[model samples]
Target: MKLANKRPFVTTLFLRPILLLLTLIGNYTGICKKLNVAAAELVEAKAVCATRLRLRLRQAQATATCIVTLIVLIFAGAGTAVSVQAITPNQAIDGLQQLAAQAEENGSIRVLVQLDLPFRAEGELETDAAVQAQQANIDGLQNMVLEQMADTNTAVIATFKYIPYLALELDAAALETLAALPAVVAIEEDIPVPPALSSSIPVIGADAAWSVGYTGAGQTVAILDTGVDTNHAAFTTGGNRIVAQGCYSTTNASYSATTVCPGGVEEATGAGTGVDCTAVVGPTNSKAQSDCGHGTHVASIAAGDDGGSIVGVAPDANIIAIQIFSLFNSTTYCGGFSNCVLTFTSDQILGLEHVYELRNSYNIASVNMSLGGGQYFATCDSDSRKAAIDNLRAVGIATVIASGNDGYRDSIGAPSCISSAISVGATDDVDNVASFSNIAPFIDLVAPGVSIFAAVPGGAGTKQGTSMATPHVAGAWALFKQAVPTASVDEALAAFQAGAVLVDDNRSGGVETDLARLNINNAINSYVTGLSVAVTASEDYLLPDDLVEFTVQITNNTGSVASQVVLTAPIPQPLSLDAALLSGDAAVVDGQIVWTTGQTLNPGQSLTRTVSFVVKN
Candidate 1:
């Protein structure tokens, strides 16, 4: 046979070094016997080797094989020595496997089942008759069964079984125990923080101007909605202010044919979470993000300050971005279904927890929840939402909730109807309640929520919604908190109510029903004018049928100071104060005093002495 043309031995030259390394490894490992066997095969493959050379190669291979065999023996002995010292099994490995198989055949048990038991009894029990007697006396005791199983000196068997399809049986008791487990880091109630709004007119008159006074500066307000563009001017305060509270994006990981995440909503520059609907360019872009820009727009309107257009109700507020729902489509569709509403309960719950954690950890005082669920079959009493609201209240946090946009009457959805929140209804620029804003007894007040101009994400234009109504209130609450450092939650709520302009219908009724309803301009023009009044005790103890003596002192603090104050006390039975004893120029001005006692007790003055009194006990 003719030999194929051969290349130069350059390749073998490179292989020579590798061969040497393998030889060294062989020597160390004592596998030189296998190394020699390979060498013999290599010699046979050489086409030009002479018979003498082949014989020499074979002799060398044989010697190498002997060395390798000795090395193999040495390594085997070492491995055997290590195994013998590490694990001394009572039964051979195969024998144990056979024993397990036999047991499985007899008992219909699985290998996994055997290992699941927490403990196993190897031999006979130790006698303990007294303990068995006591255990048998317990209630619900099956005497015969206990008698048979209670032998202290007997072998016992325990087992674990796998139920079909069920991973484990976690009973109600187990769940309750799990809730109290140390691994359960937290267990809190869900809360509702709805939105607030202002009257459409930019000004609240003079008295009502700072009536809801707030700067919202240095405070963070998280808007858990579609993702926001951090670079927006409305949010960044025209390159001047920026909220330090961190931001996070958690859009859906899974995608559907109708809905795509991180796309859809558009800004003024026309960029948004949506893509071009016309272009079928793969999954890159197809929908518009502007259709449902309610969240971003409301967020900006509540706290935006791009130097112009329309200043937000609270210009210095911070923004927290959360995308629980996609902004890619106006009417969110899913899985080829139109108007497919995917309830984002888990996401909403997480957002609530995140806000709660933020408040507890960082002292975020105010939060606004602009979302609402449709009125379902559940009643307010049965709803579990109170847990969240209560949790928020327990931590001294205030929430603003938007009364739903549903025009339907008497049907306010959860969290808004939740007793602990400030449920806001919508009012138009004309001061008329928005036709779309849902009204209910739970609604704390109404604000400008109709056709409102607010910020959108991605440097976008403004949009409108009752959703915009909430942030306005949150910003105002932040301001109220800032103004009255000593304000309690109840006091703060009172201040809010006392400052709201009384809404009215065209017929002059405080509450309007139709197109004619408007707000009375100065109805809510009161401030936190310092409070002052004097009290007198009529003879510490009252004896039967004796006349009492009493006197009064009063001071003025409504910007000016003058004498003449009036005090009214609601006398409960068994405890009546002499109303006549309420001295000073008793003039009542909207639940307040008109002037000071001596006729001119200036702004900072107080009655120097206490009034005296004697009562008939």
Candidate 2:
């Protein structure tokens, strides 16, 4: 400072300049540190942003895949739903129409609906196709469509869930409702006898006896007709005769034309069947009793035991009776033309449902339907009658029906014409075709149906009709089942058909040609081959009663047969025991019993017994 007074002025200026330079250096270092910290923060933020973007892209891609899968599943489900709806409704209705038309052309007014579908449209179009075609377009459950039909001038009637009742005793409200339909040509409560019986007697050839061998004893045959005479000597006890019994009464006796068995006992009613109210357990008829004894006669021919002079195809076959109407009313000919003409399709459907139950509940093998509407078709449908046939066949149950009493050449009746059923025609003892039997291409085979003697409710009597003939085939089928313990339904049918001989020319023309011939043993073999398991029943006992009873000891040889196997034996008529009680054990598990009954030994066991039974009075 002192030097500045003389020569220090320059030194002081230089020191001030150095202090200024140091201050500038300190400010620049602070700025550099701040810049470095800001750049590091920017780099971290950029890395986080890139990671977030990648996560969002992955989420979007996953969402898109899920959406695509859901769409595909939804489309597939919609397509299946549409397909089912289409088949159950529109398609089913169309199919029914086609079936109905075919029936009408074949002279049948009845149609069947076997599936779970409303049948209102069928009743509406009873007479006019155009009206039905138009009405059928309306939804089956549409109330507006129903109202429109009420106001229409067309003669189309519609009925649903109806049961066949005799003309005089059907529900008035139901009948009235059906009658009021605009398209209703007529509303009939009377359900005719199934195509089981023919208006005319059946004529079968002598070969029928030989065919009897095929029917096995112990096979059960169900008769969905009038009540049978279980007490008849001609019927086998525990044999091929009356295995079970049932009856139904759906009509009043005063107005019904049906006749009851000779006993004059009205079939029990109130349950829609002709059954004995007094008897709690027995084979009951689903219909009413008949006064004409038509059911009795038909049943006798179908499964009567092989008596000295009277023998049925499957005498050992048991029968299950199901009466549709009362045959005991003198005022009504329930078994005659009136009962046949007044029959409706609805009644038959219920009868078939009962049959299904019987097959399942009782293990019934065959069903004999001697009743049906006079209709036929090349194809099948769900119309009322067809419904029953289809349902019966679907369950592996065999149905035998009479062609019809109608003498129309080239025409067959409903149920009879159904391909799944065995349509039988009446033949004479000489194997001649009956004139009244409906001659048609659909006819499967001919059997003895004319002037056949059978058991009536009261006593034995002779009757003629294809109804009698239908039972013959049924009994034979039962025997076939017995012969071949392990036979399948289709195989049995084939073998039965194979044994049948065709009659090309009418009996009067004297042209006899064997179309097909079936033997009892041969049919049995064929059936065994068609089954999934082998049968091992090997006990044989000749049981002679009004019904033929055959006892056999069996073991599951191949372990393929069902645990509850059925045993069948074929017996012949004119059966008698010549020796004293001969009881011996054939094997530890099997035994033979030969007993001499009260009757003289005129009839011998040596006779080739197909189904043997004693004729009961």
Candidate 3:
């Protein structure tokens, strides 16, 4: 087997060493007998639990420092499980003990059930026919499980079509019934995920790619967050950049929050449904207004373009927007804040499923999810979102996530902590890891995230966090996908890691892990990018002698430099464009604007030239 191009950054993951220590605490009859250090090892393992306490402090302090809300669902039920009901062994999955306690206290708990059988993603079932058959088998098993648990006091939230998992709001009896079934594997709480954006664009060398070309044209990136501001110029370049949109939010009385999707129901899909975070009204907070723009800011950082004024990582890449957040207006669940922008784990999975479904249709290089919660010291391969993320990976879509802003020294958040995800931490312009960025050993990459200026609800704003850092890498993933369509997730990540500039944690007493910071120009070997220029008229069909407006858009695709560039084209009538949009005043000769100065357009840089002309008036 060829083993050369594997990602060294993660190939030597700290998971193995941590798991080795964990195994001793669980079952080590022979090892303990042989080594005779079981007591000391157990003490060490218990000390590791201190890290968990630090995580709580980090989350609790967010009310003052940041807006990353960690939601802990309130326990409410009729009584304890009827007669100490049996719980299937789910020791491998974390948080079950807490769920059991909650169930014991309330007699009801909502948990995610994972079946042993996969929804056709586990093995080598490549062909369409094989995949379909596997899916049918999965459906049959899930139906059987549902039928068995039908008598218990349970409500089904949702089920996965490609991943073998189900979100169920059930009582203790139902939990017992579902866990006992032979097909059932593990059960975990569907914890809430907090909204987590942008940056110094040229610091990462995105402009170099624009100089040549390769600005993520002819591809799409899925944004699974609160929602995108599609009306913003960052998204509306020539036409609507959001090629597709979907909504997956749930209104649960458990959190005193309602669904963010339109119709006030659980799920919906269509145009304008993926609007900016302004969907929620009647709420006010110092953080609420800016937090509402989280989705838009994150999206803009990844692939936003605004008539040459501001550009994202992949300026021309289309977007598949999925609003996965729910509006929590009650201060009870808003961490004492007036409102909270959050999403459930199941909602994130739904967004991933939507992206996977569109993999064949669109050149979806990556899915950017700048939301996460919970904390894990080790790789969370058994996380509820892992299946959906792995499903997307099988079809060649990278799941890029923010490493969280908790400022923990040795831990990242839940979904990003999952092994398959390309977790990104935040770095400043000087390549120093941001003080607040999580620095877990499992983190995949870091990018510029300090005071990143990107599109917000009504205008542009600057925000700093790992959430901002993730999109820079996500946009870079789109560029890599455009450059090498067939590259696997690992391959693309490896390419970036291979070319990345190394940064160390100089923060006193920080995690000793050395991290790779994003430097696309260095990583792609050469700085060649693709460029795209577009021209559009405000109204295609205007009556004679009517005033018309023409739009000329020139986007730096990818590459280093395009010499002797001419940015002029034939129009119905002679018209002049806004000089601010273009890079230079070219040699205007023969009714054409020829750019004579050797200009350098950054990768994903866009220049929009607008001209309003009176055709015959």
Candidate 4:
């Protein structure tokens, strides 16, 4: 029989009412038929009716499932008319189309169109052939739209294979047609992401870490921003620190290791030239040089060399500068923040893809993104950006991002709002949250971001924003990675969180914000070195003026060596340490046995010392 409606009637709402009505009708019929019978027979008939009604209800529920299955089968048979929610355009795409329509200008707008692709589990390895096949599918779909646009005389700007999307310039009139394509799942306006805009490192205890010799020597931090200054003294480690650079902005030329752009000069000169050499190449405007000096400042905060005055959080870590923003022109204003800096999500995505590609060459431990725009709530709305971040993190790179400078509650922007990224807010030198820094539940850590001094393109300068705070955490990650090369992003994050200093006061509005401030020394001491000490007395009981011996043992349980280890044992009450009885570099000072000259403890190594104390009644 033909169904009354074409729509599926499998929902419980439609079936429950019908089932209840049937039960009611059955009960009524049973009562009417039983009224003529004896009292015992009528009671039995009522009981039997209840059992039949229960069975009918269960059968109705099962029929609903079958109806749902039938609906699916019917839709499958209908071919292209089947409605799939996964391929439908989301609200962000609709919003962008409306925005495009409202624009008075008649120029083509750049948009990112995302496609629904097969799901890949975290860390799942796909063979080169498989990857190329998947990319071919995406490219084929993209080419279809490009061909359609070619007929209408529109240009395709760029295609992305890393995240199943394409960046293209499309006219307002063509947006509706393009969005209606079956492969297109989302289309968002490519907005400009401005630089968030560092700090006193000592406030975060980087000095202590440095003093202990964990200077992030073997680690590399990738900076994705406007660019870095290769000539800057901060990055100049005799051509050893600045390892690689590339320009991913659409305005600039494609990837080049030896040349920054088409005719740009190589940063390094000499025998180890061109192939596999440690030199960065990009346009002067987007390379190690900066007109706004934002990227250079951020680079200095993360891994700049130590000058006499200013030192970076990870002084010895190498830098891989990826310029995602081209030189800003007059027309490109980043939401009125500044006229000189602008970037797009497509550029950022390209930068992330490049980072993943160069992961093996650079062995990058942490990535610092001190730039963001467009406030996004709890989760990242852009699938391409989120997927890129996840892929980088899955490969062991710690992605640190700034929680925007909007100063609004829960206004952390996209990429930063992404759950996997280490979202960092800004605090003043005194551990108070910065007024301009965004506050949200996702903020993982806060660092000194007010009037922070670091290496600018011209010279050392000071700037402020959550941007400054982000590199501190990135630099800390470098240090952590240096200590534990095998640690994952989550492991490093947990270490930082476990070692962070809780700041219950000094926030804005005098309200108690429960965020932990960065404490690099605590991170090193607690997580990196894994140093522990235990003390035990030779005898538990002692009489008046009795002699007692105490032993102290310190162990290093990590994979790295622990240096500058010192033990301080306070003389218990009613006890006094004898200077003459001290042994193994131990001395009595002010009723305490102090190991002034610290010893080095190798991995899985322990050191013990003995001292004698006199008990006084």
Best by lDDT: 3
For model 4 the TM-score comes to 0.67
After superposition, candidate 1 runs with Cα above 4 Å error: 1-214, 238-292, 327-343, 360-363, 376-381, 458-462, 504-617
Candidate 2 on 406-476: residue-level lDDT in tens?
76566677667777677777767666677777656656766766777666655666776678777767766
Output the worst ten-in-a-row residue range by lDDT, candidate 2. Answer: 600-609
Per-model TM-score on C-alpha atoms: 0.47, 0.49, 0.70, 0.67
Per-residue lDDT for 1-617 in model 4, tens only?
Answer: 34546544445545665767677677757665856766554554454444334434544655555556556766575445655443233343657546567432645667787764553413454554445445455555566557666655345656766566787766766776666555566777766566886347778888878877788898899988767767778877545588877765545221111222223432222222112212322245442324537778888889887466557899899988877664344333422322355567777877787778878887688889998876765767454577778778888997899988888666677678888788998889887788888877667888888998888765788888988899999998888787777888887787777667666435444344557789877666655437666778878788876777767777888877777754444456766655664556777765556664276779898888776756656
lDDT of each: 0.43, 0.46, 0.71, 0.68
Instruction: Give Cα distance to truth, residue 336, candidate 3, Å.
Output: 2.1
Q: Of the candidates numbered 1 and 3, which has the greater TM-score value?
A: 3
Error of 1 at 131 (Å): 40
By TM-score: ranked, best first: 3, 4, 2, 1
RMSD for all candidates, in order, please.
Answer: 26.4, 27.8, 21.4, 15.9
Residues forming the 10-long window of minimal summed lDDT in candidate 3? 67-76
Q: Over the full model, what C-alpha lDDT does candidate 3 score relative to the true structure?
A: 0.71
Give the Cα error of residue 146 in candidate 4, in Å. Answer: 3.8
Compose the digit string of candidate 3's lDDT tens values, residues 1-617: 13344334234343433454455434444433454445545443332233223323333343322211111111213463333332334454456667777776766776888876634453346565556555655565567678878888888888788877888887666666666565577898877767763337788878866665668988788988888878888898778888998999888776666787767867877896776465554355433534348888888989999976678999999998898877777676567777776788888888888788888789998999887876788898878788888888877889999888888888988789988899999989998889988888878999998989898887898889998999899898888777667778877777677567667888877854448888775555422234455658678676655565556666666544344334433233445433334332443344334443245556576666555544432
